[model samples]
Target: MNDITVFPTIDDIMAAHQRIQPFIHRTPILTSEAINQIAGCEIYFKCENFQKVGAFKARGAANAVMKLTEEQKVNGVATHSSGNHAAALARAASVAGIKSYIVMPSNAPEIKKKAVAGYGGEIIECEPTLIARETTLKEVVARTGAVFIPPYDYLDVIEGQATCALEMWEEGIPFDTVMAPVGGGGLLSGTALTSKYISPKTNVIAGEPEGADDASRSFKAKELIPMVGPKTIADGLLTSLGKINFEIIMEYVDDILTVSEAEIIEAMRLVYERMKIIIEPSCAVPLAALLKNKERFKGQKVGIILSGGNVDLGKLPF
Candidate 1:
């Protein structure tokens, strides 16, 4: 079994990058003159929205699935996610020629459900609660004997996520700060580890939705706070921070900033209008935080990881 207690090292991240390179995209780094002018900073958006599953979850899911032992692969992988991770794992499992069982809430977006189904994953719907999701996942695993691959908490998953930041660093741009949206903290924690390792001077910050600000609260309190009654339009970010992810963030992250719902919607709209890019609300949290605190990042080069672009067109907040 893969050791969950062990933290992934820089070498592990490098190897993960190598192992999954063929399966994932080297998503582009985009910059906008209008956005730069508005924010009073040079911002590079690492466009993971163009990633294989239209999210950075592809990296983590692919890494974890590919690393499974042959014996483990036979029964395939299982996970509980509302959207991105479910689609990502399904796609990754398809690439590995294995089955993927996704336990999603019945309220999960239809687009996400379609994506998972398109990738040949079996969808099991449950009540729209954390406890329900976990309970259903446990039942599915028990019945199918599928190896459970958690959305964010697993070491291999985090190691996979580290490669996204690894790509940003390899681009040779010395960003003064690197930022990502914090939900389960897979992307944020992985980004923190890579930034600290590659450019220790570069501050690593995470942006979170005010409605679901467990990460910010946890960071300030120096303890993992479970998310309760999270209410945000950023549906993908409703999950609580993972234990492994929290530990890494506490060690390497500089700060956690929260942005309001209006700020998130405006930021998402700005990207769509100015940059002509479609980004979900969750992906805009980092930009929203930066825009809300422009004075702090004035004249600095900031790198923001655009987590995904899986928004429902029919239900746009704009």
Candidate 2:
């Protein structure tokens, strides 16, 4: 079994909150009476979609960027991401007066690419394959001497991700279960760690797309599952979990669940129609899992981190 605890403790997570306080947004917690009725339970939705870069990635990227020294800052930073992380790094680096070098898939959403440019990030387009993205980022780092900021695989980033849980817990609401969609596992790993530390009795569950079910399989197999191409509509949750993230999640998390593409689409529509919130398919996985397995959470106070709200409304199939 792979056994390691790579996440920050409650004290450490709290400290990171203070460290990144000025740079990050404490996103809102939304409640809907109609939605709550449908679930047959109280639900708290942490709206990270309103965060900088239109996702919660801002917290980690901002924290990681600001922690660099003045000398290192001038050398700039590099990273490979689907969309949100690239935008977060670009915006955060702009705020810190540092250059951002982003390597992204050529097919990435234009709006996100435009946002990166708007924040003064230098974009290098690469093919969508994992190898191509890594190779392109490697060349950039070698050429520019810019440090690589991984999308979801650093201790600083994980600590930054934990702050959402800290902010949510401050509401004084006790939750029996907490769920967050796992992408590269930064956000969900942090959620699991925070829930374990602050509320030891609470269960932390990760909701992953069935097409990208590495986390779920790894958790059950008790080992790192090599990630393959992710085929799903939830573009934001396609990446594999990092080693550090997997370790922390394994130690602190209770379970990793999955949702189908159809379920994700249906849940996205439900969130929009009932809660009046626009969410991407990735963020809908948690809700989909809950509804798909309603008996487990029927009466429990559930806290779900809505990962993002960047879906193209015109693309909704329903």
Candidate 3:
């Protein structure tokens, strides 16, 4: 059994929030009566779309960058990401006055590439496979002697992510469950840790694309199952769950739910139409899962983390 207690505590999350306060956005929480009626539940949507870099990844990246040693900061930072985290880490490094090296999949959305460059990141493009991305990142780190801040899978990153849940808990509305889409599992694990410490009675749930449901599979099998070529329109969710993230989630998270691609598109459309806010497909997974199983959440108060808004407008599935 994994030692769940070894994970960062609520105090760590509080510290991260304080550290990144000046650099990050305290995004708002939105409530929609129409969405509430449709799901038959009270839902609080944390609008991370309005966040710095237009995603909650800013929270984790900023915290990580801020916690770096002077030596590490001087050496700069590097990471492999195809979406929000790439831009977020780049932006955070720029704000901290450090160089950022990014290894991005060549097939990654053009919008993401532009965003990373806009943040002053040096982009090294690799083939769209995980192997290629990792290999390219290794080369970049070797050449630049830069510290690699992974998109997820690090304690600092996870603790930083926990601040989102900590803020949600501070909102004073008691939630029966809190949900977020799982990709590499940083946000979900952080959310789980926060719920465990701050709202022990609250259930933590993860939503995953059915095509990339490794986290849900791992949860059911009681072991980590790394994904291989999982195909999903939710580009942000294509990565496998990290080992640390899986252990923490297995110990504290209540459930992992999977939703279809069509379901994701519809949920994204719902948010765009009803809330008048743009959300990426990954952000829609939690809502899709909830609506798909409305009976399970009827009459309950649920908190959801809208992970990002960095979608390619021209390539929208809807």
**Model 2 Cα lDDT, one tens digit per residue, 177-270:** 9999987899998888888888999989878889999989989999999678789998887788899988888788988889899998888888
Q: Give lDDT for model 1.
A: 0.93
In angstroms, the error of model 2 at 32 is 1.2
**What is the model-wide C-alpha lDDT for candidate 3?**
0.92
Tens-place lDDT digits, model 1, residues 1-318? 564466788888999999997789999999999999999999999999999889999999999999999999999899998878999999999999999999999998888899999999999999998799999999999998899999898889999999999999999999999999999999998999888988999999999999999999999999999999899999878989999999999899999999999999999999999999888889999999999999999999999999998887888997
Which stretches of model 2 miss by more than 4 angstroms? 1-6
lDDT per residue (tens digit) for residues 1-318 in model 3: 655537887888899999999878888999999999999999999988888999889999999999999998998999999888899999999999999999998888788899999999999999988789999999999999999998889999999899998888898989999999999999999999998898889988889999999999999999999998899999889989998898899889999999999999999999999999998899999999999999999899999999988877888886
**Number of backbone-clashing residue pairs for each candidate, in the order shown:** 0, 0, 0
TM-score of 1: 0.96
Candidate order by TM-score, decreasing, is 1, 3, 2
Candidate 3 Cα misplacement greater than 4 A, ranges? 1-5
Work out the TM-score per prediction.
0.96, 0.95, 0.96
